[model samples]
Target: MAAVSATVILLIGVGVPVSIVAPVPQARAEVAQEQQRATDPAAIRLPSFGSSAVGVVGMPGVLAKRGPQAPRQMASITKVITMLVVLEKRPLAAGEDGPTITLGQRDVGYLDQVIAANGSWQPVQAGWRVSQRAAIETTMIPSANNYAETLAVWAYGSVPAYLDAARAFLKANGLDDTTVVDTNGLSSGDRSTPTDLVDLGRIALANPVLAATVRMATADEPNVGALENTNQLLGTDGIDGLKTGTYDTGANLLFSATRRVGDRTVRIVGVVLGARDHPTLDARVPAVVDSVVAGYHDLALAKPGQVFATYETRWGGVGRAVAAKAVSRVVWSRARVVRKASVDPITGGRKGERVGEVTYSVDGSTVVVPLVLDRDVLAAPVWWRLTHPLR
Candidate 1:
């Protein structure tokens, strides 16, 4: 009987079940996925530009969806980088003269063919010479490939050397995604992104000489009859200068505009790559600029503690009091507002005393400042109040 009882007890203990740990609930899994989607690059719907699009308003705001990662064949827009590289390495002072380039037999032959094919020409005769300024004007204004090649050869002593410099410049400027097979942007394989072009535009505008060249309506080359700027926005209100590019792949435009708002002057740069046609870009570019301006206008700078009408706190001896003034100022984007509150101890705050902190969030960024007790609370006590307290 004793053996039987021991065996039964052992069987009962051995058969007892272990508690199973439950898996995370399905709802929690769904929540986690939603959070991931918010930050996932693949999940977001970026705007579709055949190449790319980037528009910056003011100093720190980009109003457009920077598109997907893809290789794009940028046409003449490649010249923007060519110009940038040249300016950085060889800065020309105002009215500084450039080395005169006399046409080689090969250059002369090419110029004649290009001039006959299209009225656009750097117009170099075998013996004719030109200035760097004239060459730059032709290259930037009319997207002249002849002048681009000529300048490349003159500056670096060979077209290959000039191309090496161009690629090096692009890589140094955070335009790693770009590839330049040629200096003139004549090759369809020469590619870049709208993001890259916007950066190029920003760099180009920093050079006063380059800026002036792009803004000219027409320039006369020593031997080249005349070169006219193809960018129509030069004379337009609020638009000064920029470059334009087009090829069978698509049309690209880099537009820089300046507008005065009150005492502040704002410069905006817009890049649109791979439009169906020139007309489409002509309409879309201005709309993008208008959107950026509108978005910036809606942004506001808030005084600290504006999120709460009043904050009330208790004092052990003085009873309840409302904070008199807000803590600090906050600048926020036009998007939704988020507020957070905390407390700090000031000079007068006893243990556990409440000084205040208010945080305001704008466009995913936050600014936090302090709030202090009103001055009236610190005023001297009144003698009449001490004597008449009973009443």
Candidate 2:
């Protein structure tokens, strides 16, 4: 017989009692990351010319930029900003001609300055009565330099005041790289980059009055007998209303277009500067637009029945938590897809019960998915209930 320590308690009953506790189950979850697609800048052929710049921006931050940040002479593109600033201060109501302005000798005097300086002009007569709408068309469409100056002086009471307002407008809109000394963009002093112009182009398109006026090939006004749009590319390849500029420095064009991607229309804006001539500048407009629109495609992030988590028990029972269905999203090139998952600590769950959740995010957009059990995870069996470790 073995000797027993006095400190050790011995059970003298016919059957020694045993206490067993059911095992706890641990949750399991993992992120299944999807491979991201690639976008080659060279895939979209851009124009190679003297100091040219280009950029594209769309919904959900689909942005790609190229070319130098240097400020080039904006030429007539300055008129685009002139119109925008005017609209911001004096918004025209739908089907309304806006407030009336009687043309003074000064407005006509400015027309004489255009003639002496050899700037483009629409026929203007002193004491001519006109609505604000006609002046907007007379400013944007024919690229009329005198009407531009007239409209500016009318809006701000002086050319210096208008320039001050233009600078303030540029600063408020985050166009730090742009500066304007004139509303007509005739002077080499007016400067901006393709990136800034692209932003300005979008702002112009948002205004229905400005957008509609630019789309017209020609407009017959009471003061100006006939006015023709300088943008020949208007209404071509989804190209609509925009501004065109030509100067001793270089030619400039700010273009806006919309293309259908799946069930959505992706609005695009292209800015090209420093081309050889107007036709050469016009040719690259569609290329800049097509390159951006072609990058759209629907992407799949997750599939149905994909296991995202699991439930395991010490008693040898397990169940998988899976995605109930597939997930897809509309994305542009170089967009990223990321996932996060969490599982609840469940001792047991019936088949198809929810255990936790998973979230997928990309480009400031997110989608949540539920994690359901693939099979039932029952409590410990009778044998396990009797044979588990005693506590």
Candidate 3:
């Protein structure tokens, strides 16, 4: 490249042509893959745990199902819906239990039926009044069958009425494949698909009261007394609220997790149904999650004040175009940063004035950046202008 002379004075009666060219960016053979097969949710290895499915509600929105989509037994994960309906009918603010639900003779009868059937129990007594928050914790943490019924009756006055409300809630929330025949999930009648459960996890975590209640490893309330949460994976590896379920059908788990990558928080909601056992689910769920966490990468396509191209005039001027802002996003797929620069060489331009533009396309999303002049580009000297022959 020849040095553009700056000391040379413009000549009189002589016209000189000026033009500048900027190089276009090149993409590598391995760049911009159609999919990140290595870490894509569909491509990752899943444990053999009968019929299962996995999904994520995120910026990229990923979903994969390896088993049947038909409704299957969801076990105690039904409690998630139970808690959601309770909060929906009687909303609870942060740290607010809303109101007290007094246990009645009917609740005591529910208690007997649950205990006689060998369903989960949290020691509910007749005439015992507990705050709505405590009630949610009771049903969620210990997977209490009776508390679930007690809450439904307390909120809706009867099990049949509660089912009516639950059915509406399911349809309104777009959970078309899920139907709850029993609130406690003790009966095989309550059913959902692995795909539908992901949406269930999303709705459950969206409510503050229910989100906080399910994350507690142990509940120490007066009504429910000391009870441990069924989800043993809570507080591990960014895992938080949600519920777990197990029955003859198999083990199931719903999770809400957050991991930091670059400047963004990547939140993941995952559901897996039909694992061999609790231990198998504990191991397999995280293994599936690890694929997502590790795949998140800070894709820096541009930086503030970074010059992508330059232009020089053959007559006497030079200028550069720089990005005005930084562009970085958390991505799990291929990042192909391709830029097309359209520049106009000017006889004069003010510093910061847009002299060119760049179009950046990542995946299918496109962003246009205005390239501004990095410094003032002045016209040729007055003598050079006046002395130039009129063509």
Candidate 4:
């Protein structure tokens, strides 16, 4: 009877081993699924575009687009590129004197035609040479066609040369579908999509000088009388001067605005094309700007030190465990989906110990990557160590 009793006890102890199980909470699983869905780019329904348009509200990659791939005549917005190319290749120092620009016969001819058409002009008289500074200011503030042509000639020695340089600049900046037939957006042939124009605006905003000039509501030049920016958005709280383009075929505008939301500074770039007229543009651009502002939010899907799971260490003594935090906080569009994640332990882990890991499915296959301990794990407490030292 004693032997049978001992056998039964042994069987029972062997049948049920002492173990620790940490199950993920229902809320956590839901959060993970939500995050996964948000990170998947295919799930998002980005705005559609007729020719290519892109709008970036703030960081965290909240990119909205309409006709983001379609090409359209950019008009004066092309001057954004003209200004960028000049700044990149031949930068002028702040407070430095302007460079002398000799007015050539071709420049004079172009100026005459622009003035005759009553197009935006800098009052550039024939044989009246102007400083490079004057030409740039005129081009930017009033969207002067002659000023752009003059600057193009000064920079590249001729209109054709300037166009080649502009084309090269566009190609280098991933504006493959864009083309520039002229430095000034006067020609309808010089076309780009709203997507490309947004990119150009971002590039221009990076330059302190260019950004400052664009923000100015009015500027004076030797050749051109006081010029006011055609951009109506300028000086309208949160609206900075970008550029406006108009022609018989289409009217377009590219605007970059900055506003403080809580402790963060949010920058919004808006592009509108094919508006019927100035009034239409005025009505539409502000709405787009407001949309971007309303959509902007601090993506709080992930938090610092938030633990996704807790796992026991295989090699460590009893009561030893590890906690894993979500990877970097991700802020992406709604449709983006996160297929998988990885964990990197910061401290206290033994070799082969389950410090952390990520389990996810991708394309119908489960993939796992182990997160090893970043720091060495000390032995268990002295009291526990005495009884549970490395077996």
Candidate 5:
């Protein structure tokens, strides 16, 4: 009886720990996934002739190009540069009239010069007291060559000084391909590439005063009476304003527009250099704007209950790791989207248990979605555990 009792005691002690504390089989995850749908680039329509480029404001590089990247005559678009430079010296807050600038003999001389050259001008006379905003409006709205020269001289002391400042501004802004010969773009030497002008457009839009002044279709100036904007494309096709220029050889336009894409507000900047005429350039701009707007889409990243990984056990238990809810992202031009999944081994758990997670990234933004089990994974039967020792 003593020998039998000793053997039974040893067996009971060993079996109890084996059944209670022994390890269960780990769940094996198989990473099987279906390919995401592919997207194509939009057919962006560009001007048939001349040079053109378009880009989103915050994005890097141009989205579309139709002509050579080499510099071309940028006509009155030079005023945009002039405005940028002058504002650097004489900055103005939005809605502030700034200091009063009294037109003098030099300003009148500027007006006479533009009239003689057959360039754009608004009437200005010596001794006419004008607010700084009015001068800017006159310069930009009517493409007045005289006010441009006047603003340049006023801000930096003379056109030559303004030229020096302009060069500095260009260098600082990375517009290496752009050259400004005079305060106004009247000189054919005023040259820039479609690419550089697009970047310039971004710079102009960033300035609050220039942004507001350029969009005005008409402004009542103290000296010039009611001045009309040279950019007729304003208030059309969502185009607000930038600048316009034309010379004997060709016309050019640096334009900006506000567009909506999937609940996101987008600013688009573009340039058309060497267009045959203003009408032709204006006609092609809408198509370019539309193409850019169409490039953004809401991409579906994951669907509710979509399986990302399959969980299986040696004990004949099976489960699935799935997305808990739908997920999506707003992306531009089919930007490359990438995903990664992380799942943990499991012995058994109830349905809807959080297993792990999946991370998605696109256009420098990230999104995380939780992964859950599709069904409960039952533990190995007690009889099986008792008969088969844990390895």
Candidate 6:
């Protein structure tokens, strides 16, 4: 009788706890996958003339390129650099016109100077007072060469000083292929490759002042009245604010557009340099944009209530870990997608309890989906706990 009593105590002390509190079986994950597919670059409609490049905003590297990679004449697009450099010294906030400039004789002389040079010009009168925003508006909206120089002189006190600052800005931004010789691109000295121009376009779109100003179809200036925007592509297919350039070499356009891929909005930046004419540049730009947009698509990674892992216990309890909801991601055509699963050990749990997660990643973007039990995992029976001492 004493031996029986001792056995009972030992069983209660060790067997009961081992069965009730010992670690349960870990869930094993099983994943289903589909082969990844790549987009063909040959399918993209790249410009046949000059140099061109396109890239999605926030992603590194150029998505597509054509023509020679060497730097080419960029024409009026040089105004973009001037605007950025000047604004760096004189920052303009959204909805604010910034400081005012009083037009003097020398400022008025800019009209004749640019006119004689055969560059674009907007009318300015001596003693006319213009706000900083108005000056920028006059400079960019009409691609005015005179105001570009005027703003450059006003911001830096001389064209030479502005040139020094512009060079520094280019270097600091890693635009080694670009060179700025003047505030307006009228000088053959202003040159940049399609890749550098694409990066420059990205920078311009990042600035609130420039981004807002470039989208206007027309802006009313204090002295110049209403000036029309040179970028005729604005407002078409979501093409927004950006700069344009025309020179003896060829016409160039640094453009930005937006499109919807899956549930995400994607901004695209592109540049076409050394086009034969403005008409050719305009027609080619939209085609390039559409082709780039076509390269992005939504990939289905997982579906709702699909089993990813299974849980089996020594006590005969069973459960399945399933995705709680559907998961999908938007990715470029060449980007590769990968999946991983993680699960935790569990003895038993109520239905719909979260147990694990699955992650899908592509090109630095990631999506995580929760895994839950599809059925209840009941507690082990008392008989099993008492009989199985070491489990």
Task: Tell me the TM-score of each prediction against the true structure.
Answer: 0.65, 0.75, 0.84, 0.65, 0.87, 0.88
Model 1 residue pairs with clashes = 327-370
Tell me which of candidates 2 and 6 scores higher on lDDT.
Answer: 6
Instruction: Encode model 4's per-residue lDDT on 1-391: one tens digit a residue.
Output: 9999999999656533321122211111111221364432323232232332445543422266664446778888888889887766668777544678777677778878887765666665567767666677888988988878777777777777777788888888887768888777777787776666777778788777788888989887766678888998786658896888888755677888886644467777767777677666666555556655555444333333444443333334222222333333223233232444444432234544554455544324454444433334544333342333332
lDDT of 6 at 54: 89
Misplaced by over 4 Å in model 4 are 1-52, 57-62, 67-69, 95-97, 102-106, 126-129, 261-263, 300-332, 335-391
Q: Compared with the true structure, what per-residue lDDT tens digits does model 5 show for residues 1-391?
A: 9999999999888876777668977888897542334455667788888999999899988989997779999888999999889889999987899889988998888989999999988887789998888888888998889999998998889889999999999999899999999999888899999999999999999999999998999988766798888899998888997888899978889999998776678999998999889998898899889888888887888899999999887778899999999987767776777788888878887899999888886656888899999999887777667766754
In each prediction, how many residue pairs overlap at the backbone (N, C-alpha, C within less than 3 A)?
Answer: 1, 0, 1, 24, 1, 0
Model 1 Cα lDDT, one tens digit per residue, 24-85: 11110000011110111112222255544545543442445565536577777777777766
Q: Residues 1-391, candidate 2: write the lDDT tens digits.
A: 2446322445312112342343433434344444344432334556777444444444422255556658888888999889888877788987789999898889879889888877788877777899999999998889999889988888888999998999999999899999999879878889988778878877787788988887888999986788889999987888876888888656778777777776667777767788779888887778777877677666666677888766667777778888877777767766766778777777778888887777877766888888888888976665665554351
**Pick by TM-score: 2 or 4, better one:** 2
Best by lDDT: 5
Looking at model 4, residue 188 earns an lDDT score of 73
Which consecutive 10 residues in model 5 have the weakest lDDT in total?
32-41
RMSD of each: 17.1, 5.9, 8.0, 9.0, 3.1, 3.3
How do the candidates rank by lDDT, highest first?
A: 5, 6, 2, 3, 4, 1
Deviation in angstroms for 305 in model 4? Answer: 11
What C-alpha lDDT values do all the predictions have? 0.60, 0.77, 0.73, 0.63, 0.87, 0.85
Candidate 4 residue-wise lDDT at 375? 34
Instruction: Give every collision pair in model 5.
Output: 76-245
Better of 4 and 5 by lDDT: 5
TM-score: model 1 vs. ground truth: 0.65
Q: Model 5 scores what on Cα lDDT?
A: 0.87
* Tens-digit lDDT string for candidate 6 (121-189): 988889999999999988898999999999999999999999899999999999999999989988897
lDDT of 3 by residue, 26-105 (tens): 21111111222222322454566655555555542244556666888888999888878877898878988778878878
